[model samples]
Target chain A: MVDRIPILKMGKYLLLSIQVDMHDQLALDLQEDLTEQIVRHRAKGVLIDISSLEIVDSFIGRMLSHIANVSRILDAKVIVVGMQPAVAITLVELGLSLEGIATALNIEKGMRWLENSVNEDEIAGEPESDEDTDAPSETGN
Target chain B: MTKTQTLPLKQETDIVIIRQRVRKAAEEARLGLVSQTKIVTAASEIARNALIYGGGGQCLIELANRDGRAAVRLVIADQGPGIADIERALVDGYTSGSGLGLGLSGSRRLVDEFDLKSQPGAGTTVELWKWK
Candidate 1:
């Protein structure tokens, strides 16, 4: 199996590119890899681009949570980008992002979110970002 | 003896792998895709349930009754604490874990024949059959 995941260094942030087919356990590996990169680089932010994923299931959902959790511990903010509408709908239904994992329009937006978060954190001494920031409100839209 | 296979978790995602491998093996044995998908869905759902509620378990997919109808049997077993109440678990919408909880009951809806066994503090085993 070819590994379609890569970690690219752009300034202090790592743009982790993942093109996943049938995203199941593959997400787990990606989570682990991203966590390692966060620690190794002592980097400030992450941009995980998963636009190529076809299906997002429970495992992938869990992996995203895991990645966000670990990245926080490493003092690096994470921004998830390029989610398909189907995946977004399913995630809302499943309520995975009840813990605030940022989602931007694309990799650029994610990177900017992380960069801003990192800059803000450095100034304010890393206030708790608070979970559920990304959660869908009860409006049920 | 034919090599026995072990699956990671009884999950919808794993179902994709199960169907693909089962179909490949079935085609090697001359089985078609339509029947394979139906049966695998039923069996995979049961297996997936075992993973989530049973404290996580694996799916044991194997070939059985290569003679009669060339059927493949998948035994999704979990080592986690078993379901507290069997009958309630079978009831639709009785979800304890995450997602839709459509796996256990939905799996029952998919396969030709479904056999479910669970013992609290022990684990769970769901046997599903797909016939060609």
Candidate 2:
């Protein structure tokens, strides 16, 4: 049986910590499952902890972007936390800044970032327009 | 000195195996954390290219010492339709597939040395080297 990355629900946020080297199919599955979980739980933010991930290839990179984009469409913000310095350098070298996605140094910081974003969204009043304003321009049709 | 191991790139599972083998080889070469991550990431990109774009081929991982410096080398070759423009293919954000077009250019940036050779209707071969 293919192992599934566990997604935990904490308050209004969903937490996913990737501890394994993800294959392409698994990445796709996570994308599908995470989006579904977001809708079911009506999560306001997602914190993906990748501290254990040794490498982030283009496929996984794209998957992360896809997840962020999809989550945005569903009215959720995504914060990718715990990315290794090495991985970050490699991604930059690979020409992937993981643009338009929020990031933090660790899970603690990630949680704080999510809290701030949720609060900011609440204060913004018109959540729909504010989120639309932050959508990655290239992905907007 | 040089030691080499070859793996077939026939399916998705093969890509996983390739990454594991590359990680082991990098360890044997005593590459640091970032270097190891870079080489492994590069290897994954090219191996996937071999399977998806090249229609499956083979990968060779080698540990070598040049000019008294140690390094790991990867050679992923495919016998597929072949690329018409090697230059264009290496450009960032230039993909013939659904990918973000960062594989070739990004992999190139990850290693210490890189080379690519392709002939239309024949095959494509990518050589990557990372110094320890």
The best candidate by DockQ is 2
Candidate 1, pairs of clashing residues: A100-A132, A100-A134, B10-B47, B10-B48
Docking class of 2: medium
Error of 2 at A91 (Å): 0.7
Give lDDT for model 2: 0.90
Off by over 4 Å in 1: A22-25, A125-141, B1-14, B18-47, B50-84, B87-132
> Given candidate 2, what's the lDDT at residue A72?
96
**DockQ of all candidates, in order?**
0.10, 0.75
Which one wins on TM-score? Answer: 2
What does candidate 2's lDDT look like per residue over A1-141, in tens digits? 356889999999999999988878888999999999999998999999999999999999889999999999988999999999999988888888888888999999999999998889888774543344655548647
lDDT of 1 by residue, A75-141 (tens): 7788889987655654443333426677887877777788788888779754444455565447756
